[model samples]
Target: MMGEAARERRQFWWFMLFALLVIGAGIGLRAPWPADEPRFVLVARQMWESGQWLFPHRGSELYSDKPPLYFWLLGASYALVRQWNIAFLLPSLLAALGTLTLTYDFARRSWNHRVGLWAAAAVLFSFQFVYQAKRAQIDPTVVFFITVGVYGIGRHVLLGPNWRWYWLGCFAAGLGVISKGVGFIALLALLPYALMRWRGWNGLSEPAPRGAGKWWLGGASFLLAIALWFVPMLVTALVSGDPEHRAYLNDLLYRQTATRYVSAWHHHAPWWYFIKVILTQWLPFVVFLPWLLGPWRQAWRQRDARVWWPLAWLLLVLLFFSASPGKRDMYILPALPALAWAAASFMPALVQRRGLRWALWVFSMLLGVGLLAVGLAALFGNPGYEARLVAERGLEVGSGALWLWRVLALMGALIVIAGIVCRLRHVLLFTALGVAVTWLGYGFGIAPLLDGESSSRDLMHEAREQAGADTVIGLVNWREQQLLQAVGPVTEFGFKQPEDEQWRRGIAWLQAEPTQRVLLSQDVAMPDCVDRGQIHPLGAANRRSWLLVDAQAVAGCR
Candidate 1:
């Protein structure tokens, strides 16, 4: 049998494989959901169908909230898979895996192999990391590029001076900029190290001065790569003479990056919003954060670049995002690699402190007991939470909900058992495994059930049924957010709600044929008799619906 350290070392590959399987469990199970997924997926779908690689469209209109790299990747994947949900999400998933690989390599380069593996594990089970990794969001993809840039820059500055690595880092930073608005913020992470290097400050003295003119080469590469997208937009705008096109490019360059940071239009939160998210959403790892401070302090005192580089990386990234008014819990995801590396630095040198060990033991036991109680509640509690919620919302659910309750209960039981068993030793490993299992259950069991109720597929099909296949289906006073749920292409007929255009135009388009319908998600007060249209009942699916001169009512009205 292998010794304990050797056995632990050998377990690395298996753990990585397990992490992937857990992350991958629910990628294909649900439809593209609203609030984010469907709109972006539809953009990719439209981009592919039109064969327009440069600009993207949301249905009929040009979409300009973000840059094009994420859509480009998503569109390419979707073109190959021919499936909406799977291809839409694969880019983020692959980006997550890339991020993990980069994180592991970086930690390995900085410390020993075991600490690298642990750093990878730290990222794998992070609450915010896994949450964003499983979805079709652009943050994960952006984070990967950020990680690559950081790794390259860290190597160039901290470990040894390498011009090639510095150039590659700049190239990645350029790609990052095209991927999202503030990707260039990642490059700012180098400022602290650069400042330290210039001053011959602590931890940066003995690496020897950099080779001559190296900085110029790196700066040029970043500028050139970033110009690839901007220059095309400029040329197109000049040739086509579309003012909107020019505005779009200008917004991407400045407004989205600077204006939104200072006065965001959406997701507005205070300066302390990130502080709250860091404490709450960055779970498991956040618990180990205080311990990290000691390592940082030690690094500062000893002038150790290996340790202090990661510390600077984390603080600079965190402060950069915090300065923005447009705050989200996942906005800080690009900083996690730094955080993980910093935390894992302490792991290799951890002493067998009895007091710390005993406290963890007690905490684990208590958590186990609480988890067991929750499992019992899930297994046998009356008025199941899912059922109660469904009933309250005036929604229907199938027997599948029951199965979810049972599976969740079983997962809870397993978590509790693992927690109790590892109470005295390997507490983090046990906790990480439990979190992975819980997330797997969420993906496979809990998510699909929720989606079934939320998706308006049935209502969309019903609209098609009430009207003919060719009838113009217009969403009236309903946000175009879920237009991706339509059985076929539909027009938007609402205004001033951050959704679509006016209703009169849509009514005219529908009345052009005399057998179309306008659907509303909320009830509308209709006159006693509608001469031009009649309300079509959709029961619970829609609040009010009208056929613009219904086929049967058309002749009657005339």
Candidate 2:
């Protein structure tokens, strides 16, 4: 018979293969989620259609709020197949795959193959990782660069003092910066390792020959990478006197970092925000905290750099992001890999102790039972629940809800079986399987019906039919999302009240243009300088929800 190690190797490869297929298949299913996905896809669509690769434009205006790296990838994807949902999500999916590969490589090289696989699987199946990686958002790419940078730097420190690895790390950091403003923060993970290396501890001792020179060269490499995009952008802006470019440069350097960090415009949360997110959103892994305590105690006893590096980095990230007033769940995505590694310290116990494995399975089964209860509740709980869902999310308690429950039940049953079996192979395999099934159910079975109401595709299409496609559409007292999903070039305008300066400017702009259709929020009032003759009120989805106005009624009121 093959040895246990040999068997685990086989299982790991198969599990990875299964995960790969599942994640890829997930891309083929599901529509976009709003407030993020549609906006991103629309921006890329606009960029692709405009052929203006340098500047990102949404509808009629330049959009420079985010750096253009993800947009470039997204626009490129849109150009390839012209499919928004899957195409826009491609970068994140690929980035996630890369991250998994690197995590596996790092863990395998540092520890055993089993440990490495466990570490990767911990991240791959992580709730946040799966959720974020499947979306067309900035977080996945951000996480990828940050993780890759840490992995690269780690090779130089732990394995050997290789110049190339150091340079690679620097390059990754540069890419991370371009990917998201705060990506450079990922390098902070290397600090504890560097400090440990200086002391020559954790099986690492003696300075790398010419390490100081490598540091300068690495910094130079980073600057060169930054110059690839930044310098040209600045020069182009200067030459063309593009006001948008000026704003982009300013935001890129200042407001996005310093101003935004100190006092934010939105997503304002206290220091405890990330703490709550870490506890609630990043559960199961966080459940392994007791498992982690042992490793930390061991590492502290041994003064081991391997353990200290990830732990210290976690501290730094928590402190850094916690200090910022502006916070969101996705903001801390880059820190998850470290958490996984730190958590995977418990994998050593799983390797040797069958009792511990049984305990873990018991935990899994208990968690599964709770999930099963919730899933069952979702299906048959209360008539009020279904009514509330329809009222709030426009979801019906139907086959989709049932399919989700079925998946959850299967998940629970499998966990209970794993617990009963109480074998290491069974535990790892079933845990990974549970994540796979959940995502599969979401991606294939449940998401279609669920997304129908969540997505704005139908509403946008129906409104266009009412307003006529040929008519120029502008939004006043409406969300930018409405314009994003609309059929044509829908102009966006209006903010607070009619008397507000920004709102007045929007009215003036709408009046100046030959707009034939206008979508307004129900609460907003019509302006006085207007032609009352051209205004027509179309039926609305909800009263006081939105107002569809025919701006073609704009008589020569001017």
Among the numbered candidates, top TM-score falls to: 1
Provide the TM-score for each candidate, comma-separated: 0.87, 0.85
Which ranges of candidate 2 are over 4 A from the true structure? 1-13, 205-209, 351-383, 396-425, 494-544, 551-558
RMSD per candidate (Å) reads 4.2, 4.3
Model 2 Cα shift for residue 291 (angstroms):
2.2
Tens-place lDDT per residue, model 2, 1-558, is 469868877877786776666666557555567657766776777777878777776666666677778888997777787777668778988898888878877777777676777778778766788788878888899889888778877777776677788778778888878767776776786678768767766744235535577778877766676677778788888888878778777876788778888888899988888888877667555656655677688787887776677778888999999998889898887887887766565675744566555555565667668666766776666646545555545444576556656666666666556556644657655565556666776677566755654665555676677767776666666544566566875666532224344345545555665455454434356566444555554333222334455445444434
Give candidate 1's TM-score: 0.87
Model 1: pairs clashing at backbone N, Cα or C within 3 Å: none
Q: Per-residue error at 386 for model 2, in Å?
A: 2.1
lDDT of 1 by residue, 191-242 (tens): 8787777666554435654666787877877877788887786788678877
CA lDDT scores, all candidates in order:
0.69, 0.69
Worst 10 residues of 2 by lDDT: 538-547
